[model samples]
Target: MLGPNGAGKSSIYHSIIGLVKPTFGKIIIDGIDVTNIPTHQRCTKFGISWVPQYGGSWSDLTVYDNLVAIAELHIKSKEERLAKVNNLIRKFELQNVVNLKSKFLSGGQVRKLTLAMSMVKNTKILILDEPFAALDPQSVRMIQQIIVSLQMFEKISVSISDHSSRDLLSCVDNAMVLSEGKIVAKGTPPRSDKKY
Candidate 1:
């Protein structure tokens, strides 16, 4: 999704995740209606997860603890939770700061942590809103790589919304443009020589 401010990109994501209900439409996942389902149930039952624009973190908790907490919500066994957390930490290169409070992590680290937390339950559909906002070039590239790997290797379906489409053109298979809460265009992203 590519849109101007207040164009309802975030609203769509919220609605899908059960954070905000739609006034006149249904939300279906895997051909099942889930519009009225609770957020936790949607997550655990449907394998949907979301990462908001501002990274989701328990500021006081250590990176390792944050991952553990998220995993515990859907995973029953302590051994399973630990296994997932450890794998994510290693994949995101977070082991060096695993014991540090999330509040002390750099912007990039927080973003990576949020992504890791969202995957704790083996989410099938991952929604990210403004994932590349407020990050340096290196962080942006790193996150883009991770997103691609998640889809290619983990088989996760990823949906993302952002103001600029530059970073996403190469990663996404389809693009939609929204204006005033309505879709203005939907198709492949413009080629390098063309404008959207």
Candidate 2:
């Protein structure tokens, strides 16, 4: 999704995640109606995972612990939880800060951690709202790389909504422009492909 601020981009994401209730329209995913389903059920039953704009983190928990905690929610075995957590730690390149509390992580690292956290579940569709916001150039590039990796390597469908259309142009295969809560334009996004 490509939209200016207040274009209802975040609202759409929230609605899909069941954070905001829609007045009437049905919410369908993979040809199933999930309209008005609770957020937890939508995530667990529908294979949807979301990362909010500001980065989702349990500030007091260590990087390793954060991954473990989320994994435990879905994976039953102790060994499985540890295995998944460690794998994501490696994949996300957070080995050096594994024991450090998430509150102390840099902005980019926090973003990476949240991405790892989302993968703890068998998520098929990933929703990222305002992913490129409030980051330095290098951090933006780092996040972009991870987003691409998640989509290509993990085979997860990604829906990203951001006001920074230039940054996301190359990242999205299809794009929609929203204005005043309605789609104004949509198609394959124009590629900027600027080297970061």
Which prediction has the highest lDDT against the true structure? 1
> What would the per-residue lDDT of candidate 1 be over residues 1-196, giving only the tens digit for each residue?
9999999999999999899999998999989999989998987797888998885999999999999988888789998888889998998789899999999999888988998888787779999998888778877777788787788889999998889877876677788999999999999765662222
TM-score per prediction, in order, is: 0.88, 0.86
Candidate 2: segments with Cα more than 4 A from true spot: 190-196
Off by over 4 Å in 1: 190-196
Per-residue lDDT value at 73 in model 2: 85
- Model 2 agreement with the true structure over 62-90: per-residue lDDT tens digits: 99999988888889999888989999899
Error in Å for residue 43 of model 2? 1.5
